[model samples]
Target: GAEADKGSLGPDKIGGGAALADGVGGGSALGGGSSASSLALEALVRGVRDDVLALHLDVLNHFQAAQEAQTRAMEEMQSRQEAMASEVASLRRQLSAALQQRDEFRWL
Candidate 1:
């Protein structure tokens, strides 16, 4: 009686041994059996793949937006720096001209 019970408890006796099955070819307890299990697994994989691809695309879009914003900021900074340089040059030229006029007046 004990041996009979043990045999019944073996992997093969349960779920058509589907749990112990190695791969797609392996049997399953599902009503449609091994093929159904394989199809279900494939569908799950495909769904995950699609979701991951969508997430990757969203990340890329965000990255591109950030890059564009940074570029604009850099360009604005560069333009401001150029304007400041021009102002400084103009101030220096005015100072030089004023100094030359003072020297001429001292000689007079």
Candidate 2:
């Protein structure tokens, strides 16, 4: 819009805040500030973006580590549950054998 409205002589093309008079001049774009200020703003934005990215990466790493720890804990719990089930089954078999022996003794 700036280039279209101001023609080829807009201040934007000259990097000046105002137009260069009757000669073809590019006008300032949407009242934008000087190029130096824009560059500074860009640098500031870039720095902030970098900081956010770094923090995001850190969070991802922490989440990944936590997930891995939880997975290990779940696996350990599952193993313990299996062991307990096996022990219970062994105990049941022993109880059944004992009862059988007692019945034989009674018959004798």
Candidate 3:
């Protein structure tokens, strides 16, 4: 049987030596795998960022629409309140005139 060669730095080297070096350095499987992983992670992060931004925009749009609806509702309520106030004033004048006529008739 052929003697098993440990690695580029030889079997006497400690802790898997030059074998692990090749795995981490250029032209090795680990190097290619590391670069591929980094690229994939970057792409995933960008996609997530874009998705979050889209969601934020959607939320802002909804809030703006709600604000506009609230403004319209407030305007309508204000107009109704003004109308009611005028009606109340007219009714008060009519009631006062009627009371004055009743008192005059009693006095006569």
Candidate 4:
């Protein structure tokens, strides 16, 4: 749906608008104050609006993808941190056990 809709926005508007806008010229589309001139202005406005919407969609998609990637990276980092914490706890327990054995031997 999106691909198809965006597909329409480009060629038709660029091609048609270029032709009509050239014919309509700059000031006449407004200064002429004719119904035909107004219609051309309306068409130009619609073309610009469509182009802006398409650009907005592109930016939004990029931002969403970036956010998703950031979320995945955060999750991976969290997992790594948790694993390191557990490993550190295990090493501390081992160190305590060694110290206890040394103290007992010293008492003998």
Error of 4 at 34 (Å): 7.9
Q: Per-residue lDDT tens digits of candidate 4, residues 5-73?
A: 443434344453355345454445456555775877767776776586668666666776667679999
Worst 10 residues of 1 by lDDT: 4-13
Two-way lDDT contest, 1 vs 3, winner: 1
Question: What's each prediction's TM-score?
Answer: 0.61, 0.65, 0.65, 0.64
Can you tell me which runs of candidate 4 are displaced by over 4 Å?
1-36
Best by lDDT: 4
Clashing pairs in 2: 9-24, 9-25, 9-26, 10-25, 10-26, 10-27, 11-26, 11-27, 12-27
lDDT of 1 at 105: 98
Model 3 misplaced regions, further than 4 Å: 1-34
Instruction: For residues 38-57, write the lDDT of model 3, one tens digit per residue.
Output: 65665565566556655665
Model 3 TM-score, 2 decimals:
0.65
Clashing residue pairs in all predictions, respectively, total: 0, 9, 0, 0
Q: Rank the candidates by TM-score, best first.
A: 2, 3, 4, 1
Candidate 2 TM-score versus the reference: 0.65
- Compared with the true structure, all predictions reach lDDT values of 0.62, 0.60, 0.61, 0.69
**What shift in Å separates residue 21 of candidate 4 from its native position after superposition?**
19
Say what the RMSD of model 1 is: 19.6
As a whole number from 0 to 100, the lDDT of residue 42 in candidate 3 is 50
